[model samples]
Target: MKAKFLLPILIAALALGAVQAWAQAAVGAPAPSFTLTDTKGAAHALADFAGKPVVLEWTNPECPFVKKHYGAKNMQALQAKYVAQGAVWLSVCSSAPGKQGHYPADEWNRILAEQGSAATALLLDPDGQVGLAYGAKTTPHLFVIDAAGTLVYDGAIDDNPSTDSADIPGARAYVAEALDAVLAGAPVPVAQTKPYGCSVKY
Candidate 1:
């Protein structure tokens, strides 16, 4: 009887895991579209950026790993550097309501301004629809979509995983590198990597 019970439980667990795995977006596939409200209360839709290279930054203000990048201006500098070249940088907050990083829209903007964030928009994803669609797992998960709406890159912000600003200088910036390759019509050397940081509050 115990063996029979365990068999059913194992089957159920495997089925659940399969569902979750299927929910994740596959690289090289067309990115899933989303319409999210920005920190300014303006609605921003992924479809609006169809013909431009877009960067989606899954972030949380309270994550120490995220703080390491913003506190050191590493993330902001990257945003400024690329936005000047016509890239649209969209910062996404997928923290669920009552979670560690959950905050009101106004508060989100306040924090971004205080940090001098260089993103074009601060998008709110409190319901986690967008996060789930992209299979974002961490506070600083990064994704890049090319002008054709194809997901060109999905993974960590850089090679360094430590919560140390000192490591930023030596880290291989995955997003920047991927964007450069796409712009130059070259294949992305590292299309994906294990994303490291706090688990997204969702």
Candidate 2:
């Protein structure tokens, strides 16, 4: 009888944990606040970007899905376009220490330069705390925060989930749409979608 009772209790606890995890950075909710160091050693906080649109990009330099965008210059173009329009684009690396994408600041700086990244900052989260808080599940996952700090969008970069750069031309660019809507003070047509890519190396 004790074993049966304990099993149910354990199962309920697990279910509750799952729900809590899923709730982080939920769409329409206030994006979770965090401060992280950039490749240049400058720290950035969500609050600092208040009154401006913010884009949080979960990234792994070694991920093929990420490579698909970078290699094709699609991601850089998006960064340049939005950054030019006054949006703050933050590319975050959540890969843990010793992981495939984890790199020291100097190396990260080199990599970003080599890739021609145009992000406002490349924040590092090697311990994965920020990633967990945002429930980031994939290297290429993306989230958009409106000026009001609400999480307006979360999911894959585009409608196409494949690793083919050719697919990008035909796929709907979800992040761009979200940024446009936010900048225009309009509602996001699609707020959320299933994210695809290599699992975040936590």
Candidate 3:
């Protein structure tokens, strides 16, 4: 009887730990502010981008899901288009040190250069603090903040979350649609959707 009672207690404790491990911010709330070092060692504060639109993308270089967007130049095209429209796109990697996608400043620079990415900064979140605070779920998880620092949109990059490049053309492109709405001073039709991709290796 003692063993049976102990089992239920242990299971409850484990469940609590799981919930704590999956910390994330809520939608329709002010985005959590953070200061992280960019690839060049420059400090970037989330609040600094106040009064301007900002895009926060959680990324993992080795994730095949991320490769799907970069390999097809879909992510870069979005960055280029939005940056031109006065948006600051910050790609953040929260992979821990020695992890599959973790990289130091120099390696990050080379990777970005080779990929021809257009993000304003490649923010490093080696400790996973920022990722957890934002509740980033997967590589390519996207968040859009308005000029007022309110989280306007958060979810998958597009409707299709598969690894096949062929799906790109048919995908609904959620991020693109949200951005277009924001640029036009309209509310995002889909504020949040179930994000699907490789789990962020934190």
Tens digit per residue, CA lDDT, model 2, 96-194: 788889999999999999999999999998877788778799979999999999999999999999999999999999999999999999999999999
lDDT of 3: 0.86
User: Which is superior by TM-score, 2 or 3?
Assistant: 2
Worst 10 residues of 2 by lDDT: 1-10
Q: Model 3, 133-175: lDDT tens per residue?
A: 7778899899998887888898999999799878999999889
Q: Answer with 1 or 2, whichever has the higher lDDT.
A: 2
Q: What does each candidate score in C-alpha RMSD? A: 5.8, 5.5, 6.1
Task: Write model 1 residue lDDT over 3-23, tens digit each, in one string.
Answer: 225335546867778433423
Global lDDT scores for all candidate models: 0.87, 0.91, 0.86
Maximum-TM-score candidate = 2
Q: Looking at model 3, which ten-residue stretch has the lowest summed lDDT?
A: 1-10
Q: What is the lDDT of candidate 2?
A: 0.91
